[model samples]
Target: MMGNKILRKIVATVKSESKGINYFSHQSTAADSYVYSILVDETSDISSCEQVSICIRYCNSQFQSQEDFVGFYATSKTDSFTLYNLVKDSLLRLGLSIDKLRGQGYDGGANVAGKISGLQKRLSDDYPRALYFHCAGHNLNLVVQDACQMSPVIGDAMSCLNKVVVYIRDSPKRWDSFNTLLASHEEVSGCNIRPLCATRWVLKLQSVDAFLHTYEVILDFMQTAHSEKSNSASMRSTAFSLLRKLEDFTLYFSLRLLQVLFKAVDPVHRNIQSKTITIGEVLTQVSSLANFLASNASFIASNAKNDDSVAHFTSCKEFASKLHLNFACVPRGVRVSAEDYFCGLYTGLFQTASESILIRFQAKSLQMAENLRRVLEDESIEDGIIKTVSEFYDDWNYIDILRERRQWFNICRHEGLQPSINSLRTQFKSELTYKLLLPNIRSALTLYIVIPATTCEAERSFSALRRLKTYLRSTQTQVRLNNLALMHIHRDDFIKKVDLDDAMNEFIDRTTTRRNKFGIGNK
Candidate 1:
């Protein structure tokens, strides 16, 4: 009894600090636990960097506003059935129903996203409304990984680059020397080297950029290090190996090509990680990147030839333009021709990346998201737009509901509220909009808003998990770890809305009985 009382007090204090004043007072049964962690934007205002919250959308007695931070659980197994059970149990604990679950978002892993018997498939079988979305960031990362592996030269270049990063980063002396050398260079001063990580999608860009920026500095350091008698044989050998690999024309060209290609897609990769980014926006970004790559591929094919001299001239010219150096300084004796480099390797890399992106993100849900955006923003009301949306909802009559809501949509347009798809969705949540489009259109819009475009929110939570449960605090209780993560991740909300006095009072009330029985007085 005493332990339970203390635990409750701790939970209350954490919740109050993380959520805000009166967080528990309005707490109702049948809360939507899924909303608490998913990437659904719940506010009227939209910003790319808006902080997302774990909110519960409920309607037991009456439709209530979104609630924050219900609970968190820890599980070991990640199998489909086990994950499904964990979700079901968490909802049950919160007095929420599986029938109310509207959306789910996961990375593009076979376990979670597999088509035949994945967790998403299993859950969809039971609750068809729980639409599953592949995390846009993960999909992009996979696309890059797949494309990089398509060519032996590109793959070898990446592998050698990783080795160089690891060698420099692993040794303190080498890292310090590298930094000192970088400081001497005018163009690359104050730039720190970034190591590549296989899992982190954004780090690849930074790593490649850092390497390219410090390319000359690194070569000088490696050459100098290789000559020094004080350096270990292994270090000297590794430096010599990396130096030769970096000096190769094919490797350098491939590196520069990848840097440019990834840079074009970086904006899209970043946008999908935002809470405000919608499905339509993600599709648009991917399509734009694909088109950009296709156009570049065509240009390279038309302009560049298979001759070694042309390859050397083109590569050197581009390199000189970027670094502001003379083309005459480019090293001679190139092994690969321009045609092979551009038409053979660069074309494959670009085409593979573009194709992978299109393959992953081009789906019926994406089409529906696009149609929704068109309907809201353009007021197109095209013949097939209604059919597309109806197909999304698995209901033919959904088009009728959309037709009935046309007046409300016109009202929003007249009032100048329809700025974007997201803005339209935000407006649909208003009292006036709800009353005008009441019941049917309102429900449909609610469903649309709840459908997550990416699993960025969940991925963001994992970052919090790492911080909260670091090596030093590895043994912390799962519940307590989760509590701390909630507090840390949602610190903005706590800082703005949480009342310290209210939290203290709640804690006191919960612990008072136990304290009194133990003859402990309030300090």
Candidate 2:
């Protein structure tokens, strides 16, 4: 009971500190109170109750980057305007002004991203400085989704993979049988498989990797289950159906193609997902992925030359993926040759992926970011670039920014430093000269760094909520859950410095009855 009391006190401190009184920049001080950005994402908890999680990304007084969870607000209405009001109220509660917001980050969902009626559009009406950039991580996820949906064969392959995974894993006896078969096979790497996911990497690439590894083991498992007379008719029927689906050369090829595509896409996705990476680094990753897609399309086009024996090898029969036994490239009874059908698929896949990335990443956002890179580049900035950047900022004048942008570029060139956001951020913090010399440029640099690359912090908050709030604890108040979530999600920031006794005393002082009982007076 004492341990529980102590634990509660400690977490309560997490909630108190996370209200962020110390982290808050007083609006009165220009230097300490920096312009910040927000990352927003929504999820339904176990009870199917919808809630929005808000996190702020900004540079601290020490000029170090911070992405901290503010709070979660449950809402029945989720349209652009209502969601904005919820966000506005949440920000008001946190003592942050909407006018000071410099950037907005969210997924590609229409509710948030729609230019006409979306939350981004509504927020811009209120504060023009809050430029919305689609989350870079979600952009990559959408790219993969677009590529998969472009082809019907690939879609069916994905569905087949999901069905097989669910069917075998749903029954304990079947799961045990599958693992036993894996144990007997010395060649299998013992990697596990899972369902494919749209929003996360969890159900995606690694699952494809494991499935590719245990191809023959799976075939044997399916064949044995179907052939056994003692097995349930449903099990036999399912096994037999999936066995045929697996033997379809098109399905096999499509899955392999997906594995390779995701392999290329995952690295870029990982780069965007990393909190340490700046938007500048993320933009570089975007360019790199584009180049890979271009080259991969060429590689796929060149695969048109493989003949029957080369594609369907009988010698290496143990490895089923490598040795193709069936070559029916039929879709809905429409027969097509493997060479013609697969060649189109392999080439068209990356072509669609490249197009999706280009469309989804948005030229306007890229141009906005690239214009700032001019401050770190060798090029001479003219009046037009200054006007565009200043217009986005909406701070009344483009004249002062022109001078700062020029001087900032000169400083970078004079120092012979690489032109990156991280490099500029380090110099700005370490050298007091830069801050005093170019205040406008400093503000721009600070705001640029605060602009979020991803909403992964908000997603992480949801994950912490899943652990802290379970089915049995469904009756707990949302405010209490929010407080606990603040402690659990941002525990690393609080673990070492926070004192439990101080937190409990503080909590007691805030309450009228507790203060009277403890005989503590307000300072």
> Which candidate gets the maximum TM-score versus the true structure?
2
Give me the runs in candidate 1 sitting further than 4 Å from their true place: 1-72, 299-340, 371-402, 408-434, 437-439, 511-523
Clashes of 2: 0
The residue-by-residue lDDT of candidate 2 on 347-367, one tens digit each, is 678778888877877757667
lDDT of candidate 1 vs native? 0.61
Best model per lDDT: 2
Off by over 4 Å in 2: 1-33, 61-64, 198-203, 299-324, 328-337, 394-397, 507-523
- What are the Cα lDDT values of the candidates? 0.61, 0.72
